[model samples]
Target: MSISPGPSNLYILARTMSDGHRSGVAAAGGMAIGSLIYVLLTALGLAAIFRYSPTAYTVLKLCGAAYLIFLGIQTIRASGAGNTSKPKVRIMGMSKVFKQSIVVELTNPKTALFFLAFLPQFVDPQLGQVALQLVILGLLYAILAFSSDLLVVLLSHNLGKWLSSHPLFIRWQDRVAGAILIGLGSYIAWQEFIQK
Candidate 1:
């Protein structure tokens, strides 16, 4: 969770928007939806494919890293060109934000792997339906993550407001997000390539 950029980037996106609360909620919702997909897939044993096929896992990691780098470049390019109105009109609408958040979450292959590895530890096949147990645990995690991310969103939004007076700060928000994303992507890619 700490290694992933989804929450931090979500905070950054929320900070730049006029309706921080709404954007934050939308982003959280999107992330939950994306995670739901992964959880479901993991419950269905799809993630076993990754565990059995090291090549597939590596390919997914590479793809995820590439996607992150792409997003970082896009954020950097859009930084200074975003909305200029009071409170800032938001670079994108709630729907777009929702979609972006989903994409960000979905592209991180590690999330699926995480759900696969983490949920089963809590499940007792003899106690009940394993699939149902996995889903329940996954939902609980999504809710908890969303709650934590909401706090981050609120805090970042308030900080954005405090920094809004300075155009430089406003302009740098996306740049900072972009840089972090790029760094994360590069690191992930490096780990995949170098650790083996």
Candidate 2:
């Protein structure tokens, strides 16, 4: 019989998920709620902001871009300053992370469009209640995500110090993370400007 991946797997995944650097535990924790919120909201037909208007989509993409770029810049600044001991204020903390995740999930028009097209495919109303089915699936996803974050906390507890101390890793992490954010922002902006 095959065994399902458990705590150990999560630990390892979290540890290695990002070049030996880990996302904040609080961020991950908030992401759990964020995931559930998005799923639930999307299911409730509240995620339709993405599909309707070009202007709204553009605005959301810009917002997402700005957030990511700012984070990337902060990462670079932290690495340049060689201060990696404590969690940075912007990315850490339960409340901030929760709010940030929620905004990121909600503000992106793409997410709304995603929910609009995604839910009905597998939802079988004949078998049972639709809302219950959504809750079940969404809960499963949230549990998995929460577990992943816990793993991040445990595995990176020590490794983060080692990785952060290395000059190359810090600079590289910052640059790559930054570039990704900028790219996302540019892409979204481009799509909005050119496509419409």
Candidate 3:
């Protein structure tokens, strides 16, 4: 279901509209919807794909590994080339949001468990359309998460510009974002293996 823009979304939407910050907002938006899809799938009982198969998580891990490692590689590469004036934005009406959201949601096994463990606290089966309710809650969390991240993005976007142009802070933002993404990818990969 498509969410309507309301007062709740104003904070995130406003932050996203800022220069350089839109990419993160766009990314967070995509990631948010992706996670919601997974939770929705789980709520609908399609989590069976993970349940019945041992190799499922393996492939899932690899896909996640590939995605994160790809991001890491891109970040490192971009850092080497110096900064670009324009922020990156992928143009997809739905797929961008869907795919990125899923990637963010599946950032780690812990995130999955987080959804499983925490969602139930708010989801009462007695509620009509529990799945829909979960979707709403998921969207709410997305709004909050994106709001925070976008604030960071707004700050960092300028920071990236200033640092890269200066001798002292040269390429610091790239290194930081790249290293963090690489670390997160490695962490997720480790979780996939150890949890097995």
Candidate 4:
């Protein structure tokens, strides 16, 4: 699951391609922190609030979708204003990217649900201190996930560096990234709407 193709991974890829390795790593760090926050919440039984409340989950999912769409539109508009003589790369600050990544990860109900379900299967009542076990498991998961995301950042950065040389790619890079984000957001919203 750590290496799966999901919103987090796609976002990392897009950011690395558009910005650079620093931004991508910042995103990965933020996502790891976000996952760790979820781990803590799960350990404390706070994550169960989502399981018991469909309204909260739906609201978060929709908000996440809306945020992604908003970012995508902003990206596209930024691309539109780019000059051919100078590529419009690295428009966002690394700190902003980090914060946005955390928001995106937290808004993902699936991550919350995944931890709520996946962590307990490894937990043993006989081991004592169930919460500690959950935290350990969650930490390990976060580490693995961060490692995977880091690899993605490195590879995508390399690819982006190569593609950045071309005039056409530089011209359309933001559009492509924006489209990917919009598509992911739309897919998530459509899935949630249809499920309802």
Return the top candidate by lDDT.
4
Which parts of model 1 are misplaced by more than 4 Å? 1-19, 81-89
lDDT string, candidate 4, 68-157, tens digits: 888788878878755669635468899999998998788765676668777778999898998999999999999999999999999999
- Candidate 2's displacement at residue 166, Å, is 2.1
Total backbone clashes of model 2?
A: 0
Give the runs in model 2 whose Cα sits over 4 Å from its true position.
Answer: 1-23, 47-58, 77-80, 83-94, 108-114, 148-159, 171-176, 191-195
lDDT of 3 at 179: 60
Clashing pairs in 4: none
Report the Cα RMSD per candidate: 3.0, 6.7, 7.3, 1.5
Candidate 1 or 3, higher lDDT? 1
The TM-score obtained by model 3 is: 0.64
Lowest summed-lDDT stretch of 10 residues in model 2?
1-10
Q: What is the TM-score of each candidate against the true structure?
A: 0.84, 0.62, 0.64, 0.94
lDDT (C-alpha, whole model) for all candidates: 0.70, 0.53, 0.54, 0.86
| Candidate 4 C-alpha error for residue 176, in Å | 1.0
Clash pairs detected, candidate 3: 30-101, 31-100, 31-101, 34-101, 34-102
Model 1 has an lDDT value of: 0.70
* Residue lDDT tens for model 1, 1-196: 6224543344335433434667777877787787888788878987688778888878877877887787778767767565546455455678987787777677675575678666678899898788898888888888877776676677767776787777777666677877777877787799888979
Assess the local accuracy of residue 151 in candidate 4 as a C-alpha lDDT between 0 and 100. 99
TM-score sort, best first: 4, 1, 3, 2
Sorting all predicted structures by lDDT, with the top scorer first, yields 4, 1, 3, 2
